[model samples]
Target: MSTPARRFDTDVLVVGAGPAGLAAALHARARGLRVAVLDPRVAPIDKACGEGLMPGALAGLRGLGVTVTGQPIAGIRYLASGSCAEARFRAGPGAGVRRTDLAAALSTAAQDRGVQVHRATAGPVTQDADGVTVAGIRARYLIAADGLHSPVRRGLGLDAPVRGAPRWGLRRHFPVAPWTDLVEVHWSRHAEAYVTPVGPGQVGVAVLSGVRGSFDDHLAAFASLADRLAGVPGTPVRGAGPLRQRARRRVAGRVLLVGDAAGYVDALTGEGIAVALAGAAAAVDCLARDRPQEYEAAWTAATRRYRWLTAGLLAASRVTPVRRALVPAASALPAVFGGVVDALAGHSDGGRTTSARTRWHHLEGAR
Candidate 1:
């Protein structure tokens, strides 16, 4: 009897069905690749996030055919003490949506695209010159979009230790009408609180800090924000931790890392979703060309500015005096502040054209 030929269950095995994973699968399918997505959890997954989508991010989702409802965000607002700087978006409008709502949209898109999504846990990823295997299924390629702590990256020895001061994110929802159309970042001594309206009658607040406490405790740092929520009940708090994470390399043989699994810094600017969607496009293109190794360079260019800008901003916030003056200084220079906010919102034409050193004083101290 002749030996049987080996076969892969799908052309690509996607481990993780989060936004990145789902985006990768959908994009791959659009290119006529057979894709299989697996996530241990069921649909409509929820994670702690700012849940504010920049205009580019919203455009990316619609381009992928994922339609999710959200409240329009006109701009960004930085508040501290009694001073605040406001920047109206010049490119387009971003939106604030609940994580569960975004998850549902992604899941529906993947299913509608005829992509195979499995609700099974992936264990022991193995890859070779021919194909990659997870559990018993095999495919020509694998995308490890398993988030901050990616198990597939660990399995392939690509996990890198994150080096930075520890920071975490905690978020809760209040059933109140939105006070503003812009996403608000209220800076305090040791924390940054983000308030975004997810619906006409619902607002989400996420706190990024190194402090440990209840949601109310974190809110105490911002008296004005706390006063707004006085006597108002909130949903259960959701949390994500040690915000910084890293991976050794984006590629390991036939496997490619996408999304947070690839690497991440603190969520200071609320650009995670936009960057991840862009990475998915690059990743799927690389896979199509049978050039997995080239993905490392692609990944770098896709995220170079984000990593640089976020790191620089986070570093500045760590200094006590600098944190105190950030909002006030930005308030004085509305044009300069608007440029930075526009850059973060994914609008190229609205960002700074000068070097970081040139604007250091503008962002360093208002006192």
Candidate 2:
């Protein structure tokens, strides 16, 4: 009663051609599985993001045989009115490429590796003992990387509602020469603006806050940065909202969820791409082993770091007194701030606490 292998359209059908979906297609094809990826749009798509790739993210992309170009980011810097702390990446530098550049590179890589590219939007999914079918293609297994508002997730009853006050992101690019190698985060009472050098003569600024007004209004929150790009020509603003999404379960039947479709937290940490790529690899690995259920656990472990860190930081960022204390505390204990930034950069596993600092320094400085 076995169906002929040729009868199947693909071994794995991935919906959405964004970085996560394309990454999944490439990874699946590498394992010798026939893969097809579907998307509703053409290549070089753009979206709102912090756009700073941490060192780990850059390395992961190269591992999948992808090469992209952008400005080199050496580290991260946090600044407030009268407080500042910074850290340099101990692993290596990360790139700050635009979303369009990344999408183009990934699309080319997927085609080069022989992944079937379908330019169609996937509709309601129907599955049986044979497999899952969507948009006329019958795939033995399905991977949904369709993004935050995934129709596949909804059709499959996998969506989960998130609580708390919603936060959103707004981003735009400015044509101005880079001033620093580090990605600077300018925090204020109402918003946090991330300045990423995306090219030698262009920088992308993203602001995160409770739903806000014009980009000019958000830019004004960062006084010094606002002054530098006062009238610089910029790209049209792109945005994403309420900033959090989740799934009831990552794996259900022969289908698995990846990227924002699987779940998402606030983008305050800039780890979205890295975590998505990891989930893509993990989901494909499960299919390769014919143990699709194991992907749930794998997904959990893969995203544990991002989830915990973003959650804790976001929760702290919400508290009035604690939020007010952040920059001052970071400024007072510069070493601790460096450690946290290094952890975020994938240098230390967030395990190397600053308590390791020698007491001799304290005594010497006291004298």
TM-score of each: 0.92, 0.92
lDDT of each: 0.85, 0.85
Q: 1-367 in candidate 1: lDDT tens per residue?
A: 0112247688788999999999888778766577999888988999999999998788777667677899999999999999989998888999999999999999987887688878898999877778888878888899999998888888889888777678999999999999999999998888999999999999999999977777788899899999999999999999998788888899999899999999999899999988888788778878877788898998888888889999999999999988888999999999999899888887231121122112323433432
**Residue-pair clash count for candidate 1:** 0
What does candidate 2's lDDT look like per residue over 276-318, in tens digits? 8888888988887788999999889888988998999999988
lDDT (0-100) at residue 244 of candidate 1? Answer: 88
What's the residue-level lDDT of 100 in candidate 2? 91
Task: In model 1, state the lDDT of residue 74.
Answer: 94
Alpha-carbon runs more than 4 Å astray in model 1:
1-6, 347-367
Each candidate's number of clashing pairs is 0, 0
Candidate 1 backbone collisions, by pair: none
Q: Return the TM-score for candidate 1, rounded to 2 decimals.
A: 0.92
